[model samples]
Target chain A: SQQGEEDPQALSIQEGENATMNCSYKTSINNLQWYRQNSGRGLVHLILIRSNEREKHSGRLRVTLDTSKKSSSLLITASRAADTASYFCATGVANSGGYQKVTFGTGTKLQVIP
Target chain B: EAGVAQSPRYKIIEKRQSVAFWCNPISGHATLYWYQQILGQGPKLLIQFQNNGVVDDSQLPKDRFSAERLKGVDSTLKIQPAKLEDSAVYLCASSPPVNSPNEKLFFGSGTQLSVL
Candidate 1:
């Protein structure tokens, strides 16, 4: 079973606009990370936010995590056509043995039209 | 640095046949993972390995699926008597061992398998 679920299964926006995607999870997490996939290919790590952190930024990507609500959101500012891809949120859960395992969300498909 | 590597980018086989896929993790990384991604869905972790030891294989179907990482560098995943439901892309990823709660994962261009 997947621990995280992404909202807005698909989003379409014009180039230069901002795209926002949200993710909700059911379990406690040590951290949450977002990734981008193009055409069902390999995934590229984007950014990660720790449980103690509320927000993080990497270039044009901004991620915010609300542990109290068990949800997170990714915002891509000034989107480009190249930014068209599927976005996923993965949760790292602290296991009983102290190791962490990642569980991915269903993902959001974002299309940035030029 | 070279990213995770996977072989036989594509495969087609009939049901009940056997097939195997290979993955070579980034040099010096200690964590390796295999995930199965069905079309239009998220990737599901099938197994995870730390060095040459198995960390988790609970999601893997033991009856038909098996994997091993020899020498803690390269790994292989095999399926005996494949089923149509097994058609999906197999992704290999590796992460460095770090105390941080989050580790960036490098993924390979997955091998797409089609079982007829």
Candidate 2:
């Protein structure tokens, strides 16, 4: 079963605006990572926030995790046309197999209009 | 460093035909994964491997799908008598050992399969 669910299945914004995408999960997670996929390209790892973390930032990306709600959000500041892509959130759950099993959420398709 | 490599960027076959996809992960990575991404949906985990051993494959349809990482470096996923609903993008990813606390997966450009 998919562990994460992202809201606002699609978003369109003008360049330079901020884009926020939200994700919610049902189980305890060890970590949550975000990835971006350009059209006709592969997934690129964006940022990862551990369960103990409240917020993390990388470049123009800011991610917040609310363990109490089992939810996370990704924010892109001053977005550009290059930021147009599908965003995904993946959860890492510690399985009895002694490793973290990863599951992905339905992605948010973001379009940055120039 | 070179990223994960996947072959046959696209494939099309009639239902009930057989097909195969291959993956070669980044060097020295001990973990590999195969995911199936149906159009308009998130990628779903099909199988996972640690070194040459199967780590997780609970979601794999054992009756039709099979995979192997014989040498622990490259892996292959094969489907016999494919179904129309099986059409999806087959993605391959690799990550460092699970002990690496912040390990991230590197993905390859997936093989897009179209089962007619």
Runs in model 1 lying further than 4 Å from the true structure: A95-99, B100-102
All DockQ scores: 0.64, 0.65
Worst 10-residue lDDT window for candidate 2 chain A reads A93-102
In the range A1-114, model 2's lDDT, one tens digit per residue, is 788999889999999999999999998998999999987457999999989999999999999999999999999999999999999999987655456678999999999999
Candidate 2 lDDT score at position B17: 99
Give fnat (model 2): 0.60
Docking class of 2: medium
Clashes of each: 0, 0
Instruction: List, residue by residue over B1-116, the lDDT tens digit for candidate 2.
Output: 89999998999999999999999999988889999999888999999998899989999999999999998999999999899999999999998755486488899999999999
Indicate which candidate wins on DockQ. Answer: 2
lDDT of each: 0.92, 0.92
Q: Could you give the DockQ of candidate 1?
A: 0.64
